[model samples]
Every structure is written in C-alpha cells, then in structure tokens.
Target: MKRRIAREKAVQILFQLDVAEVQLPDAIDMVMEDSTGESTEFLLSLVHGTLENLPAIDAEIQKYLRNWKLDRIANVDRSVLRLAFYELMFDEATPDRVVLNEAVELAKLFSDEQSYKFINGVLSAYLQAGATTTES
Candidate 1:
C-alpha cells in the first residue's frame, strides 16, 4: 500500500486503540483486514512505534495543545497527531516537512472541517520548537 493509504489506515488503527481499547496487533489487524497488498512494513512500524512510544508522543502533543487536553481532542485529530509525531520524532527516513504535510492532509481527509488547521498549527509549533530540521 502507498504510504498515504498506510497513514490513513494508521490513523484508523490508532483510533481503535485509543477509543475501542483494542490491543496494538488487533488494531493493526482490524485496519488491514480489508486492505489487499504485500508491503505493510511501513504501516506496521507506524502503529507499533506509535503505541510503543505513546507516552512520549502524548507528552509532546500536550506541549502544543493550548487549552485542549490530549484526550479531549477529536479522536481522528488525536490519531493524526500521534501518527505524525511518530514520524516527526522517530522516523528519520521521511522528511519532517513531509510528516507535517501528511499530517495536515490526514486531518483534512478524516477529521472535522476545521481540524486541518488545528493539526497544522500543532505540528508547526512542534517544528518551531526546534525538535529537528525539516531539511531533506
């Protein structure tokens, strides 16, 4: 599957894990059940890495949130941030700009009408905080 599609599925699987109280493998399996493909390594790393590093990711997200609590944000929005943060903070192969762009796109594709801005704002703040370079 394309990375975009994998990201969409990652958001869904993360949503399940966050809301439905599903295990990591079960969340991944549920999302992949309908997908027809061979390469899932990217998707697997996303969900697994997100879950594995959830505490740190959530903490980073909390730093960006103004008044909104992590749990209080829309599920889809939260999922998008988690997935994006994993790439932004953990995955070095993908550029930080790409991660930021992908995050906004994910929010636009899945969340509420205004969620894209919210996602963009949060991720942009993360970048500005000097987490890392966005240079490719």
Candidate 2:
C-alpha cells in the first residue's frame, strides 16, 4: 500500500486502540474490515511500531504540549500525532517534511476542522526544537 494510505489506516487503527481499548490486532482487523486485501505489511508495521514505541512517543509529545495533557487532546488528533511520530522516529526512509504534511492531512480528514492547525503546530515545534528519535 502507498504510504499515505497506510498512514491513514494506521491512524484509524490507533484511534480504535485508544478509544475502544481494543487490542492492537483486533483494532487493526476492525479498521481493515473494508479492505480488499489483508492489511499490508507497511500498514501493519506502522501500527505495530507505533504501539511498540508508544510510551516513548507519548513522552516526547508531552514535552511539546504547552498547557494540554496528551490525553486531553482529541482522540483522532492524538492518533495522527502518534502515527506521524512513529514515521518520524523509526521510519527513516521517509523525510520529516513528508511525515508532517501527511499528519496534517490526516488530521484534516479525520479530526475536527481546527485540529489540523494544532497538529501542525505541535509537529513544527518539535521539529524546530530538534526532534530526536530512538534511532537518532
């Protein structure tokens, strides 16, 4: 699957995981129920990698938040942030620019109208602040 599509699916799966308290595999299955193919490897990796590295990702995000706790962010916005950070942190082949853009796009599509701006702000600040990843 294309990275954008895979990323979108990752957000969906992650949202289910967060909101429904669903297990990773089950959340993935629920999100992929409409797919013609089984979950693509890229999709699986994004979801798995994000979840595997979640504690680290959330901690990193907390550093960038001003007044808002991570949990207080809208669920879809949180999912987009996590997926994009997963790509930024671990998927080195994709540039941070692409990750940021895709994240904003996903937020626009799945989150409330104002959410994309918030997503963009946090990500841009993180990048400008010299974002570090586990792999870095």
Candidate 3:
C-alpha cells in the first residue's frame, strides 16, 4: 500500500483509539483487518510512535497553537497533527514539505473544512521555530 493509504489508516485507528479508548494493538488490528503488506509496518510504526510519544507530540503541537489550546483542537485534527509531527521529529528520511503536505491532505480528508488550514498554520509555525525531537 502507498504511504498515503497507510496514513489514512493510521488516522482512522488513531481516531478510534481517541474516541473509543481502544487498546493500541486492537486498534491496529481493527484497521489492518483486511490488509497484508509492508505498508502495515509503516502504519504500525506511526501509530505506536505517536501514542508512545503522545505527551511530547502534544506539547510540540501546543507550542504552535497561537491562541488555541491543544484540548480545544478537534480530535481528528489532533490525530493528524500527531502523525505528521511524529514524522517531522522521528522520520528524518521524509522531507519537511512532504510531511506538511501529507498532513494537510490528511486533515482535508478526515477533518472539518477549516481543519486543513489550521493544521497547515500550526505545522508551518513549528517549522519556522526550528524544532527538533531533542528540543521538546
């Protein structure tokens, strides 16, 4: 599967985990029910890494929120941000622009109409601030 597909699946699983409080493994299993491929590895990595480092990821996102609180952000938007932020911080092989674009795409697909703009702004701010995984 394409990375975009993996990302979309990751967002679904994350959303499920967030709303239903499903266990991480079960969430992954739910999303990967009909899939079988290397793409699943990437999806698993994304979900596990995001959840494992959720606090740090949330804090990173919180810093980029100009007037908005992290909690005030929509769950779908938050999950999108978390996945993108994880890539920015941990997956250095992918360029920042790709990460940002993919994240915006995810927001456009899974979130409310204005969510993509909000996600773009926050991610742009984070890039401008020159943050790295080590910093926060």
C-alpha local distance difference test of each model: 0.88, 0.86, 0.87
Question: Using Cα atoms with residue i matched to residue i, what is each candidate's TM-score against the true structure?
Answer: 0.92, 0.93, 0.91
Model 2 has a clash total of: 0
Give one digit per residue, the lDDT tens place, for model 2 in 55-77: 98998888888899999999999
Instruction: Quote model 1's TM-score.
Output: 0.92
Q: List the residue pairs that clash in candidate 3.
A: none
Lowest lDDT sum, 10 consecutive residues, model 1, at 127-136
Name the candidate that leads on lDDT.
1
- The window of 10 residues in a row where model 3 has the poorest summed lDDT is 127-136
Q: Higher TM-score: candidate 2 or 3?
A: 2
Q: Any idea how many clashes model 1 has?
A: 0
Candidate 1 wrong stretches, greater than 4 Å: 133-136
The CA lDDT at 28 in model 2 is: 71
TM-score of 3: 0.91
Best by TM-score: 2
